[model samples]
Target: MRKFLLPLLFILLFIAESLFVQFLPGDFFGGNRILAPRFLFSALLLLTIFVGRKKGIIYAAIFGLIFDIVYIEIIGIYLFLFPFVAYVISKIMHVLQANIIVAYFVSILGIALLEIGVYEMDYLIHVTNLDFLDFLNLRLYPTLILNAAFLLIFIYPLKRYFEKYAEALRDE
Candidate 1:
């Protein structure tokens, strides 16, 4: 029963993120810029930090595919990107000390990488008219700041929960 908690929490966070997006004021950006929260990614980052990269990659693949199926017209974009990002983060973890500040930056880096990958893919496919500068100013910076704040606010509790969660799994 305890094992189910984290996965259930992830699902709830996913739903909350979707709902939260709907509640955001439409003009919050006040222009063409968009400020969206990637709470799911933040959750995944916590999972990666406290659980392990292997579990993180598994969760990423499952959630990424779900994200693609529900939100995207294309099938494989997020499906491929999420796990790939998780894997990269897992690799990067070996070199960096495992600490709150490091984990926060790693989460931000993961979000940035995902965003850039999507932007580049869209640009290559001619799906977006926005150039690199516009993307940086309008999308990436705002997203990074918002997500960094999310990480700041939630990291400690999440880390404690996941650490305890992992310890329980090991004891069993």
Candidate 2:
């Protein structure tokens, strides 16, 4: 149970993201802005911070592949990007203090990296016709706002849970 708990939480977050999107009104913000929920991504960064990087990268890869299959259907994009983002965040986290505030900012960076990465790929592949400026304004900003607000609300619980679990791992 202990070993599976974190991954279970991540799976729940992944599912919740879809539900969150579904619950939103179709005409949100006059239907101009797209609010992409990156709940799992943010939590993955937090996991990297509080837990070990190896575990983080592993989970990122697995969930990312699952995410790609279930949601993106882009095959290798997220499968490649998720572990890459986790690796980069793990490197950045090496020198930073592990705290909720730092996690917030670090998560912002991860979110930006993932967003741009996916957008650029989609654009290059002709999957998205959105111009860069329009993409930034209409998609990125709203997504950042939505995910940041989510982090602000749930980061504390996430921090506490991951920190305690990490401490347990350390003691083992």
Candidate 3:
């Protein structure tokens, strides 16, 4: 049960993200389009920061696979990118202090990386018609606002939980 608790939490975040996007009113963006929070992405980054890079990458890959399967038609985009983002952030965190502020920047960077990955994939397949500026103004900014708000609200508690879990694992 202990081994699976972290991943289970990730799955719940994924479900919450999906539900929030679906059920919440789109007026937050003042239009029909909604900026959904990236709950799993933020959770994975926290997992990496508190737990360890190796376990973080593993969980990222697992959740990324589920994300790709459930959310998008493209299979490899998130499956590959999510773990990649975890690996990059893990390296960056080694050089910088791991704290709430740093986590916010890293989460934003992760969100940017994810967006770029999706954009590149879509471009290759010619699925997206929006220009770069439009994509930035319309989608990226709103998404950053939404996900960053979530990170602000949840980061401390989630970090505490993962830190305690990591300490327990070390003692065992």
At residue 150, give the lDDT of candidate 3: 89
Task: Sort the predicted structures by TM-score, highest score first.
Answer: 2, 1, 3
TM-score of each: 0.95, 0.96, 0.94
What is residue 84's positional error in candidate 1, in angstroms?
0.7
- What tens digits encode model 3's per-residue C-alpha lDDT throughout 1-172? 7877877888889999989988887776678443758889999988898789998999889888988898888798889998999999999999989988888888888888888777778878998977787778778788888888988899999999999899989999
Q: How many clashing pairs in candidate 2? A: 0
Instruction: Summarize candidate 1's per-residue lDDT along 1-172 as a digit string, tens digits.
Output: 8878888998988898899789987777666668767899788867887789889989998999998898888888888888899889888888998788898899899999999998898898888989999999999999999889888999998888888988987998
- Stretches of candidate 3 off by over 4 Å are 32-34
Give stretches of model 1 more than 4 Å off: none
Better of 2 and 3 by TM-score: 2
lDDT of 2 by residue, 1-172 (tens): 7988987899899999999999999787667788899999899988888887998899999998999899875799999998999999999988998878888989998998999999999999999999999999999988899899999999999999999999989999
CA error at residue 140 for candidate 2, angstroms: 0.3
Per-residue lDDT, model 1, residue 82, is 86
Total clashing pairs in model 3:
0
lDDT of 1: 0.87
Best-performing candidate as measured by TM-score: 2
